[model samples]
Target chain A: MLAASGKLDRRELCRALLADRGDLLVVAGLGAPAWDITAVGDRAENFPLWGGMGGAAMIGLGLALAQPARRVLVITGDGEMLMGLGALATIAVQRPANLSIVVQDNEHYGETGMQETHTRHGVDLAGMAKAAGFPRTMLVTRPEEVPALRAAIHAGEGPLFAVAKVDPSTLPLVLPPREGAYLQARLREAVLGPAAHHQL
Target chain B: MDRQVMESRPAAADWPDGLYELLKTHRIRQVAVVPDAGHARLIRRCLADNGMRVVSLTTEEEGIALLQGAWLGGDKGVLLMQSSGVGNCVNMLSLAITHRTPMPMIVTMRGDFGEFNPAQVPMGSATQAVLEAMGALVRRADRPEDVVPTADATIRLAFNTFRPTATLIGQRVIGAKTFGKD
Candidate 1:
């Protein structure tokens, strides 16, 4: 009995959030979030996870810590976030200012035939993140809040945690590079330029 | 933070220092760890080193993704954990295996030599075999002097050969954890 209060269209929100992205590295969680990111536009910097479900946020943390000069965003689903909730504590401890985690909370496990997730009941991911010591945390329900959330992500003074409640309607699949090696090489080449060739 | 290596006790041995130097030589900037006494010295050294980005993970499985992301970003990283933590990483090891991402893990073993805790025995005994089963090249360092060479081979295997490699720091090198001590 989840309320249908989410007014923001996920694809539009993703498009708006990533419209001005320039050299920003994105790690998309498995299933829906990956499609959301891909729907916006696929690039060498956008790493959409096909298998690593709960590992997106930590991967974002690693990328953020490694490339301090660049902005790192982790766009994931509520189910995925819940599975890797401990990552919030770890990310809070590291406090990499370049990192931002955005959860597309559709209140359902969309990939597995749209079953209700914990967020549909009473799970508060943003609250959990704030309790875990993230400096900035937000819950965006309305489309108007998207701008502020985008600003926070680009502000570069974060360990920001945001959960955007989106419609539970499923969208068409948008697949990125299926080969892990290709995705890895594309990202490396984009980040390190000619120096990537020298690495293993 | 100051770069001084924290513990100065001679009894602590130089194996941790040897491994630290090897990591530095390989330009490993990211260190993902779940704390354990056996890895304390190495963890502290990485934390104090200004050039290294030390990520304290809640679980060892997180290290797999972190290191994969590090490699994706054109940087190198290592996972420091105890043998017990190896059990936590089995499933996530597929991320490295399927992706063909190079991962170097430094594990301090338990339940092998003078182990007082029976809880650590099961996982400790299964650690090397588990890592090997997950397609990681496993090596062991039984003595203080063997640390550097084992780490060297592991690094070469991981980074150069594009394969996941692990070096198990033997109980003899790290010393057994006493029950009624501190």
Candidate 2:
């Protein structure tokens, strides 16, 4: 659907951001973003929403609020972010310093026949987030700027928002565990230690 | 944890106050909510307490995912909203069903049993059934005195069993909204 493709490969960008991720809790939006996170390798700290469409950012907000000491990151596609744009305002009001949101703007809904999303029509998500009171917002289109975005996620005062323009190439699907209950328990055990592992 | 402001009084225990105390006793720290007139008293009471963090939402679905995240971080939470907000939460409730997230929702009724507006009827009547269809256990507290006890039970049911539960405070308890003439 896009005539001029973005230079950055989404898989490489996700791999770069997750490298050396220490105590960072990740929430990946459903669809391509979830696949991207899973491709990098699944960790207990990583929560990929297998179905829920508009919840990644708010989930990051809640986790950040509950654990201020740890960093929280949400990686979502443009279509997913647009679906839950109101969450940015709610998250801004709370201003959880540990939270960061990154939107992979491919301008097309990759899972759904590459339908053109709002981002394709110059809908600026970074601008909206900046207006919503996020202290730091970035629009990264060049390859060199990826490091800054990663640094902001790993070690920066946030709730930061970033939208990375990525190439809309159809890639192989990398799925996480399909069972939500198992994934939920896995995360609790990781974050809360062995004690959180309770019988159903 | 400022329990003194919200508590330190057993004499004048209304249902809202009792419910507030119940949340504190249950160790619920995150109050994921969408504001509603029926729940004003308890919402204000929660905001007043230093121990509770009332995270307001633009819509009700955010609360479900927010609570799911809270559980990941080892903190418990509760969702407070009105009956109509339940419609907004249908798709999002799947996270709780599939993940078995422990979520307790305290909903104040708007359209049931003497509602003024006809617009409130559809979702209000559908609230319990919708939640049940989504695999969330449902209960109702139609009397003022029963609100706290039912809420407490539902909270235990949710956390202990890792199931999503909703406790509906009936419109009769809220004394259905009236226009200027009435």
Candidate 3:
């Protein structure tokens, strides 16, 4: 069980959630979530969005729907998720069993100087996802809860949505490959094997 | 809601079927759409195809990201939307432009050539210019016969050359929405 401080350590939580991930495709949102995933050791299977705010979940949906046999995890921020809230409804309707979305809810726009976001004022992302009909929804505010959350993500019987409440302290920047094309190609090769090279 | 307009339109042309066949031939297995009357037939065809996955989005911008992800996962997809939806997709389109992601979009035009809704005019008239400004190649299919060829060209430009392309299916091709018929 984690401390009852009500705020989990972001880095520790990310590492736990992604620990021993095998064949899991990760799409990280811009800003802190991107840094968090890269901090976990960037790999060809991890495609971090340098920009394209609000797109992480939908991108995961596409990849999940395309590669149904593999699990797709999208790690994004509350502010980014709020921008594309409609995606929850869409994802629910499509209901890709292999998709999991985790919102690192520090409750602020970390990219734009930590201005407080709606989550700070009681916006419930997990509740919204539940209302949108996600099969699994969780709100994590403690370290102990992370193992269960990680289990749910790896379970692969979702359309799952989880919000991890984390301390808002700014962390050191951990950047991934800056070039979008290179990242896309690398992820493609990783997912499709040798066939990606033959694509025009 | 727009089924009445779709049903009342002129005898369906062969182009919608042609466009569908072309997409399948190119191995497009995913379709992201924001429902519009002009694309009714195409949407129906996609939904019926066992080999294709049709996803209905709340907004058009989601389609851009969805298609990019599909390509990343070694699949091809098409975005189906109306002209008004283009306004919602402007910034997200940058994902395609910046990443040089191949995107093929079929846009059904409104607010031109016998439009009933005054609200759709501004975005409709500016659609081509806005797409061009965002570095997307824009082509128009005004007549039934032009649909397949324009879509073919769009596919070539998008997948072969790694550019975003939009095929504008004019109101002239899909038939303008009729009003005052409750």
Q: Give the TM-score, chain B only, in order for the candidates.
A: 0.91, 0.92, 0.91
Q: What is the TM-score of each candidate against the true structure?
A: 0.92, 0.94, 0.94
| Root mean square deviation (Cα) for candidate 3 | 4.7
Candidate 2: tens digits of C-alpha lDDT, residues B73-131: 88899999999999999999998888888999999998898888899999999999999
Give the per-residue Cα lDDT of candidate 1 at A154: 94
Chain A TM-score of prediction number 2: 0.95
Clashing pairs in 3: none
lDDT of 3 by residue, B46-101 (tens): 99999999999999999999998898888889999999999898888888977788
Over A1-200, each residue of candidate 1 has an lDDT whose tens digit, in order, gives 12354367888888878988887899998898888899888898999988877889988988888899999999999999998888999999999999999998989999898989999999999999999999999999887788899899999999999999888888788888788877887888899997886844
Q: Give the residue spans of candidate 3 off by over 4 A.
A: A1-6, B1-12
Measured against the true chain A, the candidates' chain A TM-scores are: 0.95, 0.95, 0.96
lDDT at A148 for candidate 3? 93
Q: In terms of docking quality, how is candidate 1 classified?
A: medium
Error of 3 at A36 (Å): 0.7
lDDT string for model 3 (A16-116, tens) is 98899999999999998889999989999999998778888999988998899999999999999999999999999999999999999988998888899
Clashing residue pairs in candidate 1, if any?
Answer: none
